[model samples]
Target chain A: MTLFDSLAIAWTALRSNLLRSILTTLGIIIGVASVIILVSVGSGARVEVEKQIASLGSNMLVVFSGSSRGMGGRSAGAGTDLPIAEGDVAAIRDKVQGVIAISGQLNGSGPVVNGNTNWTTTLSGVHPDFATVRDWPVRAGRDFTPQDIRASAKVVILGQTAVKQLFQDEDPIGATIRVKSAPFQVIGVLAPKGQSAMGRDQDDVALIPMTTARGYIVGKSQVQSDQVGQLYIKFDNSTDLKDAQEQIETLLRQRRRIQPGAEDNFNVRNLAETMKARTEVLSTMTYLLAATSVISLIVGGIGIMNIMLVSVTERTREIGLRLAVGARQRDIMRQFLVEAVTLCLIGGLIGIALGVGAAAIVANAADWPVVISPAVIALAMAAAAGTGIVFGYFPARRASGLNPIEALRSE
Target chain B: MNSVAAIIEASQVSAPVAPQSAAPALIRASGVSKIYRMGDQTVRALDDVSLEIAKGDFVAIMGASGSGKSTMMNLIGALDRPTTGHLAIDGRDIATMSSDELADLRNGTIGFVFQQFNLLPRTPALNQVILPLLYAHPRPDDLEARAHHRLEQVGLGKRTDHLPSQLSGGQQQRVAIARALINNPKILLADEPTGALDTKTSEEIMKLFGELNAEGITVIIVTHEPDIADFARRKLVFRDGKIIDDTERAPLKAATAAKDRVL
Candidate 1:
């Protein structure tokens, strides 16, 4: 028989048992849909994470004080017998290459009073370069200047949430707010940053000059700086982050007189490493989910095999008739094989439609960024087809190996 | 009269019978044997049998149960291979032919009608007839036209679209005959073609077979009933896997006599 005739015959035979054919195809449908949906969800999550990471300012790095001895014995809250003085910032700025900006930060939780309004928020002391390093956007008014830090100026930047809580509908950019026991003018209002995945209130904070924080609140001096919390470093690009981190670690170790092979007390965290760690976690989760989802595909394959075996048995008479009419064994095998593959291909098409629709719906409902890649679509299609061929082989071979006389006699 | 009597006596004494050599022989078997093993015991189905059937001969094989008549039919139809001796169809030794070659020869040379009137259930009469044509010639164009023509020849032109289930037993057998004849085989082999039919239907089927024989197609009928065997011009009876009697009958003077009797 010609290819066309063979296909026509197989099609007719399959259609004769329409319900059975549909049930057999259901396995492939589920398998293909699961594969596509799982991969889509994984890619969706990756895209969302990439977006969040991008929002965190790609060039920024966080450096906390290490437990190394320096000029001052031990700074307050500085655990180390050594202290990371304010002078180290200047030294690093002068020594490090590709260093764009550097800043010192001190965090303290407190309540601020604006007229009749009072809101508790996190207060942070920062140098003039803090805004540049952290990519902090000033929505209104000006950022702190070098002169302000030098003179211990009473000016502060109110985060979006802090401004909203204190001023409500009124503009609080140039308003006065009391911090600790002293009144300070609000120099700027920062933009809203929403909440992080860990449920941290990113916008509930205030930024002030380091000098004013040291003199009025903490009572520390710039030259002898007894307390320092974190140092924020910004590099020109991601490529320079590693080199700068290593150079800074080496400089700090040498300055503190630390020996080789000793664990450094300071933790250097660059956005790239944090991004890598986050991606690793997301990838592991995706892999686990994908592995679990693939179980459905295997089950579906088994279902296909079972149905194909039944089909082979049910069509024994038809197969025998074909064989007796001069049909080659290979021809019978090809006919069954084509039927199986055709079922899977049809199922695969339906599955792709269902999976894409489902993913789109879920992504829209959860407000996630979903990117459906063509490679994933092709992979799922190929996997479904491969499952059909692999699982459909044995039963087809059994059908081909049947004795014509016996099969015809099987009624 | 004396010479004629002497010639007849000498002929009966020397050869018992002399087969006509004018027509070419289509099938020749020499000491063909078919042994079927059942469990540990072996049963001989055809024991060292020799037979010759010439072209355009309508032959009937008659036998009781376990007489190996079916085995002979199978060997002649190329459906089964002989275990020993030479069995030839159209001068080609089938015992030496490969399975594929036998299939090809069967497709080209033989058509079979089974006792059950083996018309595939649910298939249209037209499709049933065209099935054999699918095996003939790699390309099977004009199958519909050929099937229609064959069905018409079998007096089933209007029932071409009707399925086997819709047709009566005699009509179904007619459809099977049409399928057998569609390939224009050299020989038509019918195994109890009217076994399942009523008396009248059986006579009608026999009449159709006689008409086909008249058209010069070598027709072989295997039957246990004397009435069914009477339709053929030549009758061979088998007993214990061997031919016990072979006889020839005079041709019917009028084909309409059988048709009128059926009516």
Candidate 2:
């Protein structure tokens, strides 16, 4: 039989029992829709996470002055011990290759007052290169000059959130704001940075010269007068991040005169490597979810196979009639196979519509990101067709193998 | 003819010879036996039965249930292969033919009409007639027109769009007859074709068969009813897997008024 004829015959047969045919496709529909919905949601989350990590700056590294193992063998987290200094920052810049920009940062939290409006926000102390290292640019007035840090200038840059809370739509640039009861002029307002991967508000902060923070605002450091808590480093595109990290570790160990087999009093984190690990985890989750969806598809295929078997049984006399009327065994097989494939294809198309609609609803209702790609849709269709072929083969073969005499004799 | 002369002539042709006419033998069965192993007890459905049916002949096979008549019909239709001995249809040995070749033989040379009408439910008459053509390789281009012509030939032209459920028993059988003739096979094999019909409907169907036979298409009908057998030119009675009685007579003529009226 021609393919068209087979399709027409299959369509007619399916239409004869329309309710049964539709019910048979339900499993496939649910399977395909779940696959699309879950995959889109999973990839959407991955993309959102990647974007958040990228916003922290490209090829960036953070060095914190805390021992890999603290006293009594308990490890201390980053930024716990404030022992990093200007000398350490200078040493890393001068000694390490590929260090495009480096800045010493000191973090503290206190209330900032502009007239009667007071907002408690994070205060960060940094060098003039902090803007380049963090990828945070001035949205309004000029950033601090190197001379400002050298002279312990009482100037600060306000973050977007800090600007809003303290200035209240007023231009905070060149306006003096009191930080911890000390008046400091806001030199610039930093551009908006949304949220961190850790779900913290990144824009609720203020930046000031490292020298000014150490001398005037933050008071004396516990370890030393010129102590900085952390160092932010930016690297050139050509730098291999792993090798750069290793070089910095070696340089610091040598400078501190640490003996072999002793835990170093510092930690260097490659932000890209951490983000890559996170991406890998996310993709693994996506595949796991996809694998589960595939199980449902197989279940759907089983549903098709079950219905097809029943159909063959119910239509045994019809098959015999066709055989007697000159339909070859292959013709019978083709008719049934085409019917199964048609069912799956119809289910898959419906599933695509349902999946996309559900994804859109999810994105709108829960504020979740959902991405649907053409490749995904195509894969889903191919999978549905394959399911038909795989599951339908046995039933079609059984139908074809039926003896004409016996089939005709069946009620 | 005298009774003695007729008896001598019948005895002379007791072995079922092909007619000495212009029409060639369409089906040749030699020593054909179909044995069925029914749960370890062997039942011979057809035992060493030999028969030759000439083209354009109307033959009726009359027998009770399990008398090998249906088995002979199936073998003639190429629906089953004999366990031993040869059966040929249209000059080809169907016993040795592959299943696909048998299908081709059935498609091009033989048509079957079942007792149940065997019409597909919910299918229009035209499409039912067009079904066999769907399986025809290098299928005829004038498919719908041929189906329409066959329907018209069976007096179902105006009912082409009526589904089987919407048709009367006699009309349904007519649609089946049209479907059987769609391929224009050399032989029409009807197995108990009138078994499901009332007497009037059966006569109308037999009349259609008579008209078809008159048009030079060989017709074979298997039925136990002698009344139905009276419509054919030749009758064979099968019992215990063998032909017990065979007779030849002039076919009963269909009435002229009934011939033209659509049932």
Candidate 3:
């Protein structure tokens, strides 16, 4: 018999018990729909992480001056002390071959006052190259000049978050903001950099010149005249990041007068490596979700097989009648096989629509980026067809092998 | 009923008997024995039965339940194989024929009718008739037309679109008959075809079979009712898996008169 005729026969058979057929395909529909939604959510998260990492600046490293081997060789928390000095920053800038820019940061936190508005925020004292090293640029007004750092000028740059809190959308470019009761002129407003990979607000700080911070804001507690809390370094490319890190470690040990057998007091953190580990964890989570959905799909296929077997039992006499009328074994096999595949394929199409719709809903409701690719839809279809074939074979084979006389005798 | 009128018209046409010496037997069973094993007990359904049926012949097999009449019907219909000896249908040794060849034989050479009027449930008469044609090799392009013609022959032309549930018992049997004739098979094997019908409806169905036989088709029926057997020209009585009586009856006119008397 022609395949078209077989399909028509299958269609008629399914239509005869329309409710049962639809219920049988429900398993597959839910399975495929879940697969699409879960995978899209995973891909969306990966995309968000990539954007967050990109915002952190590429090929960058941060050196914290806390003693990693504090007492009894125990490690101390980052930024606990001011061990990195202004001389160390200048030496790295002049001597480090692969380093593009370096800046010393003295971190502190206090309330900033503009008119009657006052907001508590972090304060960082940095050099002019801090903008280049951190890959952040001022969106309005001009960046701090080297003259501002050399003269300890009372000037400040507002981050986007600080600007929103202090100025409330009013122009803060030439306005004066008091930090810890010390007045400083705002030179620029830094561009908005949403959230970091750790979900920290990136634009919640104000930047001031290093000389001004050491002398006016936080200079009274300084043990050394030029000591800074941390140093931010930018490399030319990621290819030589490991080699450059090693070179800087060796140079720091010599400059800081650390003996060959003594443990280093500073810690160099590769932000790219930390972000790479995070990406790996996200992808692993995606795979786990996919695996769960695949299991559900297999269960759905088992449902198909179960229903098909029951159908064969229920229609034994009908199959016998067809066989007696002249249908070959293969013809009977094809009829049942087509019926199963049609069920799965129909369910698969509906699942694709439902999945895409659900993804759109999630994207809107949860405010997450969902990647719905054509390849995923195609894969879902292929999986549905394959499941039908795999699970439908045994039942179809059982039907074709029936003894015609016995089947006809069955009620 | 129109069935009586059709019967009267069918009886007027004399069926031509095949020339015995000139034509080969359409069915030949030589020393055929069918055995059934029920656990440890071995029962012989057909014990070394040998017979020959010619084309254009009408035969009826009569026996009680478990007397091997159904087994003989199944064997003749090629639905089951004999355990020993040879049974051939249309010159091909059924024992040696492949499953596909047997399927072809069943499709192209023999038609089957069941006692229950085995029309597909919820299917219209037209599609039921078209069922066999769907399996025909190089399936006829004018399938609907052929099914329509067959339904018309069975006096079901107006009811072609009616489902089995909507049809009367006689009408449903006619639809089954129409389905049997769709493939144009040479032999029509029926197992107790009139068992579910009233005497009037049974006579009407037998009359239809008589008309088909007059058109040169071999007709074989298994029925216990002697009145139903009277409709056929030849009768065989089965007892304990063996044929005890084989007789040739008078022509179609005698059976027609007997059916007229019942009406």
Q: Write the per-residue lDDT of candidate 1 for residues A345-386, one digit (tens) a residue.
A: 777888889888888987899766566789878987887788
Candidate 2 lDDT score relative to the true structure: 0.86
The predictions' CA RMSDs to the true structure, in order, are 7.8, 5.2, 5.0
Tens digits of lDDT, candidate 1, B98-198: 77787777777888786776666567999888876766656568999999999998899999999988999999999989988887888998888888999
lDDT of 1 at B129: 85
Output the worst ten-in-a-row residue range by lDDT, candidate 3 chain A: A73-82
lDDT against the true structure, per candidate, is 0.77, 0.86, 0.85
Q: How do the residues A1-411 of candidate 2 rate in per-residue lDDT, one tens digit apiece?
A: 899998988899888889998888888898889989988988888888887887788888888877665668687676565477878888989988999998888888889999999999988888999889888888899988999988999898989999988888787878988999989988898999888888789899999998888887776644367787688899999998888899999998887788998778888998767887988898898889889989999999999999999999999999999999989999999999999999999999998899989999999999998899888899889989889999999999999999999899899
The candidates' DockQ values read 0.22, 0.70, 0.61
Measured against the true structure, the TM-scores of the candidates, in listed sequence, are 0.73, 0.88, 0.83
Model 1 steric clash pairs: A68-A82, A69-A82
Chain B TM per candidate, please?
0.88, 0.89, 0.88
For B1-263, candidate 3 gives per-residue lDDT tens digits of: 34433433343343333323324688999999999999999999999999888666678999999889999998888877899989989888788878777777788888999988778888889999999888888688998999999999989999989999999899999999999999999899998899899988888898888777766678899999888888887788999999999876455434555345434
